[model samples]
Target: MIAVVQRVYEASVKVDGEIIGSIGNGLLVFLCVENRDTDDKVTYMSEKILNLRIFEDNNGKMSKSLQDINGDMLIISQFTLAGDCSKGRRPDFTEAAKPDAAKETYNKFIEDVSSKINGNTAIGIFGADMKVSLINDGPVTMIIKR
Candidate 1:
């Protein structure tokens, strides 16, 4: 599993012109599930994201974790993150997990993180066309893979 996590002032997801999920003062996570990912990987990734100290502390240092700040999370399914672009012009998605398995992993990750966090956990539809909007706080982003 891979996650592109961004600290955001606010974020939202829209499907077919309807807002399905949204959040404020949180992390916007773009997640991808790989073929080899296991439940252990899901738990590891969730813990890593929740404890990442990207948010600022009272000293204005980047020392606060999302859990420390009680921030929200917007998780989106993004299999494209697994695309292998080292070959030809067209990227290869062979590393991405198959749809059925990927969705199950995605949901489990969401549920695990949701159960551990204090704030909201918003999600995008597993296979739908989604539009995500956000005001990136500090434009801070990190990629975690497990």
Candidate 2:
């Protein structure tokens, strides 16, 4: 599994001109499931994301986790994280999980995050054509893979 985590003041996802999910003062996570991903990956990623000390402390140090700040999360499925562009001009997604498996793992990942964050999370529809908008906070972004 791979995730691009971005700290955001606010974020939202829209599908067919309708808002599907949104969050405030939290993280916007673009998650991808690879063919080799498992439940352990989901567990580890959730814990790591929730406990990541990206938020600033009172002294202006980046020392507070999302849980410490009571922040929300907006999770979006993005299989392109597994895309391989090493060859030719086009990217290949052969390493990404099949639709069914990817969807299952993605859902499980969201469930795990929700469980850890006390349900303060929203998710975009799996395999949907989504439009995501965000006010990135501190421009802080990190990518994690497992």
Candidate 3:
């Protein structure tokens, strides 16, 4: 599993002109499941994301976790994270999980994340054309893989 985490002042996902999920003062997570990903992978990733100390502290140092700040979370499924572009002009997604497996893993990941946070979890449709908008806070972004 891989995730691109971005701190955002606000974020939203729209499908067919209808807003499906949105959040404020939180993290926007673009998650991808690989062919070998399992519940254990999701568990590890969720724990890391929830406890990651990317937020700022009193002295303006990045020392606070999302839980510390009571922030929100917006998760979106992005199979392209597994794209391999090493040798060819076109990227290959052979490492990405198949649709069925991806959907199941995606749903489980969301459930795991939601269980950690209070009540601020929002998610995009697993296989939908989504338009995501966000005002990135501090321009803080990090990528994690496991």
Query: What are the lDDT figures for the candidates, one per model?
Result: 0.95, 0.94, 0.94
Model 2 CA deviation exceeding 4 Å by range? none
Q: Which portions of model 1 miss their true places by more than 4 Å?
A: none
RMSD (Cα, Å) of model 1 = 0.5
> What's the TM-score of each model vs. the native?
0.99, 0.98, 0.98
Candidate 3 structure quality by residue, lDDT tens digits, 1-146 = 99999999999999999999999988999999999998999999999999999999999999988999999999999999999999779999999999999999999999899988854999999989999999999999999999
lDDT of 2 by residue, 66-134 (tens): 999999999999999999999999999999999999999999998888878943799899999999999
> Model 3: runs farther than 4 Å from truth?
none
lDDT of 2 at 117: 98
Q: On a 0 to 100 scale, what is the lDDT of residue 114 in model 3?
A: 90
Best by TM-score: 1
Instruction: For candidate 2, give the lDDT of residue 130.
Output: 98
User: What ranking emerges by lDDT with the best candidate at the front?
Assistant: 1, 3, 2
The 10-residue segment with the lowest total lDDT in model 1: 137-146
Instruction: Kindly provide the TM-score of model 3 when superposed on the true structure, using C-alpha atoms.
Output: 0.98
Model 3 is weakest, by summed lDDT over 10 consecutive residues, at: 110-119
